[model samples]
Target: MNDRDVMPAFDMLMEELDAIVTHLNQQGAQLMQAKEYAQAREVIVKAEAVLAFQAKVKALQEEWVRLSVSSSKKTPRKKQPGQRVMTTMLKQGLRTPNEAFMLPILQALVQLGGSGRVIEVLDRVERMMKEQLNKYDYESLPSNPKELRWRNNAQWARLNLVQAGYLASDSPRGIWEISEAGRALVLEAKE
Candidate 1:
């Protein structure tokens, strides 16, 4: 019987279970809204099962931690910023593709405020996305190309951010400001 052989697989399963619980919770919310109590209840029961499995996984984590640390040869371990960014973003309620894009932009917007820096960052991001993305329109922009791109992406991001309570916008000034949620997201990204 090899205990170490099963440790990584168990850890992977724990992560999957955690993600499943989050998904079930989200789906359960929609079901509850639709008044489908039966479906929501089923989801809750399944989530409980996952939680039970995780209790076992947590006990196994002790063994895995010892194995990983002892085998590393190096004393102090360092994690990269990108890995930290992913971990923090995942810890928050960002579990969607649109959220993957929108959250970073929201965070950036929150940091770079009404100053010219905000426009610069937006321009840089829009340029990168436009270059990377195949189908993007350039015509609908205002006189400035920077304004054009911001007009497009910021407009879409504005609706989403506002709905999520992360941003405030004034149509007359074409300025966007971060709300409390946006600040929280930015801090999460920083961490």
Candidate 2:
């Protein structure tokens, strides 16, 4: 099966696993209410095991997405002068793609000493990419009217970076940190 098909299946499995864990927790709570301490402990243990398995599945899914993205990076295409001009004009009207945020984020974090608050990193990234951002990027998102489209796209890019092992998945909320792989990527680019 293709990546798209596999991803949805994995998502369904994760949802089912989450439901199982919730049910197990509820059963454990009921057992506790009945004063069946040993049964409650067993149920809790089962829930923990399911949670661990869920984590493993999530890791595998993230790895798959990372591999897919890495494999799908396209080589630059050759075009006639007219086509090139048209492409440039078209690009200016379109919002920046999420992949474009990866390096900027890593660079911003490195400049911040490998970690910083989300707002700080985003601000740095904005300054770095000021010339590249287009008017479309400045518009508000439909789902979140208070948030700009570019900021929402940047947050989604952050999620991709974390899944790809370039950002820390376990960093405290509101903080963004680069991983060793992320640092290596930036250094490699410099060379």
Candidate 3:
């Protein structure tokens, strides 16, 4: 039989086994009432076949479940590091932060004439983030906390983008600007 047939056979056999046992109990009682001891022994002997069938069906069902579970466990999943980080960050919704800050930060620096202090850039990014909030890209907080989690990720995004030559850092800690490379990136992305 095909696997589909085998799966249903497990449930069908158990049901049929139950009906057999019920019928056997009634037959055994009737034989006993008639004081037919030999016939009652025959009834018990008849039930042995059904009982054996039940044992075999039960074993088959157990084996199916065991194999199904083991096969599922054998398969493994792989994800990129940034994708993994984003997944973790999204799960921290209502508790932590966003993976949505990078692009907005880039756009914000460009809007500010391709340069701004870190705090000013962050402020512009936050406003843009709020405008996009209805998109449900992030979880809402009770209040805009002083320490926004996405803001922290934005800083990390800035450092990484800078290293990648997308942005340039000035000598002072908070000042930043989009590099010519960063301008090209923004232009390319717009297309």
TM-score computed on alpha carbons, candidate 3? 0.42
Best by TM-score: 2
lDDT of each: 0.55, 0.79, 0.65
lDDT of 1: 0.55
Tens-place lDDT digits, model 2, residues 1-191: 55645676777577668656755765676578669999999999999999999999999999988878432445656876545221111122267766678789999999999999999999999999999998888887654568987888789778867865779999999999999978987997799
Using lDDT as the measure, name the better of candidate 1 and candidate 3.
Answer: 3
For 134-155, candidate 1 gives per-residue lDDT tens digits of 3234433333434443345455
Error of 3 at 125 (Å): 0.9
Candidate that beats the other on TM-score, 1 or 2, i.e. the better one: 2
User: Candidate 2: which stretches are off by over 4 Å?
Assistant: 1-93
Give lDDT tens digits, candidate 3, residues 1-191: 34444565676567557656655655676578669989988988888878888898899799987776422233445666545211212222332222356567778889999889989998898787775543233433223335455565577667756655667856367788888867865776689
